[model samples]
Target: MAESDDASDSILPEPIRSVTPLTGPHPDAEMDVIGWGIFLGLMLLLVPLLPFIIVVWLISKLVEALTPS
Candidate 1:
């Protein structure tokens, strides 16, 4: 069992084995701000539109299913 575990660990990539948690400030604060701003803006704009999008998609799929191929 120990030999099998060692073999599995050896097969993993070096970066996967050496992973570490972030312990310092973000490398680029400006980029972080811009990224978060864009993410939030999209969420705000898309959440309300989601229901309509889903309704449209379902209607299209229903029409496709009902029509002869």
Candidate 2:
């Protein structure tokens, strides 16, 4: 029983550990610029669609208003 316990303990591998610390907080220019450009482009595209969304919303509201509660 003693030998079996020791054998089992030896067979199991040790737990893995890792630690990653930030070395710097500087923003990456290329990634930041690309991300911002994509974000701005999306916003620009969405802005033009705002009026269409408002029209749809208004139509739905008007329909609901015309219908009985």
Candidate 3:
């Protein structure tokens, strides 16, 4: 029974382990450029939100005008 269990365990295969040694942070130029691109893309994504902001502001003004302090 013990032999069968051992054989099954071996047949299942162990999880792969990293062979490379752990090193400190590695900052490369290409990675830096990619990071900048992602940042720019995020900022550009805000362009579509402008109309929503204006609509909300206009609604608030309309509500204030109708409520009469």
lDDT of 2 at 22: 48
What C-alpha lDDT does candidate 3 achieve relative to the native structure? 0.89
Q: Could you tell which candidate, 1 or 3, scores higher by TM-score?
A: 1
Segments of candidate 2 deviating more than 4 angstroms: 1-22
Clashes in model 1: which pairs? none
Model 2, 3-47: lDDT tens per residue?
999998889687776697647778689998999999999999999
Whole-model Cα lDDT of every candidate shown, in order: 0.92, 0.92, 0.89
Against the true structure, candidate 2 has what lDDT?
Answer: 0.92
After best superposition, candidate 1 residue 32: deviation in angstroms? 0.4
State the lDDT of candidate 1 residue by residue for 1-69, as single tens digits: 999999998895656544676678559988989999999999999999999999999999999999998
Name the 10 consecutive residues with the lowest summed lDDT in model 3: 8-17
Worst lDDT run of 10 residues, candidate 1, spans 12-21
TM-score, ranked from best to worst:
1, 2, 3
| lDDT of model 3 at position 48 | 81
Sorting all predicted structures by lDDT, with the top scorer first, yields 2, 1, 3
RMSD to native for every prediction?
8.4, 5.6, 6.4
